[model samples]
Target: MYALIVIISIIFFISCLLFLDYQLGKRNHIKNLRFLDFEPTTGDYNLYTNGDQLFTDLFDDLRHAKKQINVMFFIVKDDDISHELLELLKKKAQEGLRVRLMVDRIGSFRINKATVKQLEQAGIEFTFSSTPKFPFLYYRIQRRNHRKITIIDDEIGYVGGFNMGQEYLGRDAELGNWRDYHLRLIGDVVKDLQITFFDDWYLNTGESYDHIPEPTSEGSKEVEITSTDGGQLEDVFMTLIQQAQDEIFIGTPYFIPSERLMKALLSAMDRGVDVKVIVPMKADHLFVKEAGLPYLSRVRKAGGEVYFFDLGFYHAKVIIIDQELCDIGTANFDRRSLFLNKEVNTLIFNKRFVMDLRLAYLRDVQDSQPFDDHYTQLFNLGTKIRIGLAYLVRPLL
Candidate 1:
């Protein structure tokens, strides 16, 4: 019995040591791979706000994809737009073009098995990222691919907030006029997008291409693609907040923020930077919105402005700083996006592009209402309790 107790104690001690090591490693991981980890290269970027026009451009580009097509999305519903895109992929596959599609299991949970099989039969390769492992269900739920990426022949790419749902194209009655931002990318940065897709693809399907096609230099817009497979995105954002000079504008559907991010935002405001955050008036997820309120409340108290988008379900994950730096991609302003989900964002350091994005944000602001102390009174006791509960599981959200 004494020997048994000693053996168990030794195992417990070793486990504790390993846990401490993991915590320490995770804390320092961002330091090891800072903003400079991903080098900025010259690229041409176009900001697309109209969902109709964005999809039109995407379909047109995909129709012309001669060599290969790669797409990764968090949500790929069985709606008209999704089916249309799938048919296009099928056509490309039948034309001897290598077409690959990946969707997150949870995000695309509603996607029919019949559609997947049809795509497979049509020669289009498809896979689900972070599919559930029965015994490890919690683990599966925590890590998901939330990136919306499409790369064509390794030259052209698209990355941003719009998923494959018809509502994303502004068609839903409940969430009318879906407002979002997607980027049409060309040049050196496209290679990075392709590599990020390749990483998720290989993890899901155990397949990889021979080489990442050599990036062609097209324009002089300097950009860097930062990605986190459940890791460093929040750290990068914190760094960006810390470095902001004059003004910061952030637009996202959900607004839950980490403590570190909250502190950074308050600190930026304290330093005299004009900080404004825009979120959707009609939130798709109430629990998430409620959980975000306390943070927004704190931001308001610190002299930062929080606006509720009144026009539509504003689903844009973007940030513009001092009209000099701009970032847009799949990540949201929530804990799920920061540390739990596989996400990507492109940071562009071009005054011209930043000015365009800033203009777009201002247009959104016109359609939003200031969320002040009065908005806080709208949350009843039950909602406040739910928000408290949601906050506890935020890291796992």
Candidate 2:
């Protein structure tokens, strides 16, 4: 009985320390928080749904870039495709073109120290964004730089879901074909992307870059670049859902939304707005799919349609409202993305582009199966237990 008392006392002491740490972290985060917003800028964009074609065009642009290249991604796996990209960047650096590369410390943990040394030796500026530090260690560690952006010569840019990994190229046996949406853009919007990149670079390293040219319209498409560090995405999503009139189409890998966003979605359905959300049937991480079950069920009960993409992984983060406004970027619909991560998305207000994206969304829907009561009944006892556990700890998911 005396030994048992000692063990219980130790456990209680550790729990108290952890609780204090969490409270401190939360307080520090709120103190330094600032939200971001940008007006719509004109640009020319081409949406790439296939990985092979995207890399092809992206590589060609990188090779032809004359002045500078800025690249950042959440994940850069230590694999063949990543090696290829690194080699290309090194080659470009050798050619006297400025090259800077940044990746999240957590998301690209697979990249070793030797690779970074080689990049530095090749005259490429490299740094890891959002590295965990003291004071608010837990909260800072959880916040990731999830933006995937590339700017070449201050004239061309690429943004969206594709990351530097063989899995993204559909080589993983478990995930057969990778389906995603990315944009290749040219015009004034590239300047906005460059400014965002510069700000991130300065945060990582205390270096600021300037000489950004003035914005000039290159096409007829109007695009707004919306970026969020944290605590702002829920409001953005809610505003979009509230303003949606004719229809709302959402495609994402994870469907775990906050209470307010879920209610907004349900309210939109009540207002006669057609709401359809498509998520992957296969899960990439633990507890993610299960966590979304309750929210998806609520949506279905409110006359909203839910789809399970059966072809492969559906990793696209896109939302189309009335086929007039489209959002495509690195932000997912889950709580972690909506409230924790640093993300960037483009809001495009162009009928032609929205119509094209709508067609692609419909094609993906055709490849999906509906989520109904029959599907819910297929979960086993173990899955049901996991679903309950996931829902309980959803804020961290």
Which structure among the candidates has the greatest TM-score?
2
Question: What would the per-residue lDDT of candidate 1 be over residues 112-229, giving only the tens digit for each residue?
Answer: 7888899999999999997866433445555677889999988999999888888987889999998898999999889888888888788789997579987666667899999885
- Report the C-alpha displacement of residue 110, candidate 1, in angstroms: 2.9
Clashing pairs in 1: none
| Top-lDDT structure, candidate number | 2
Clashes of 1: 0
| Candidate models: Cα lDDT each | 0.84, 0.90
Candidate 1, which segments miss by more than 4 Å at Cα?
A: 1-37
| Per-residue alpha-carbon lDDT of candidate 2 for residues 4-57, written as tens digits (9 for 90 to 100) | 999999999987876777678867776776555678888999998888899889
After superposition, candidate 2 runs with Cα above 4 Å error: 1-12, 215-217
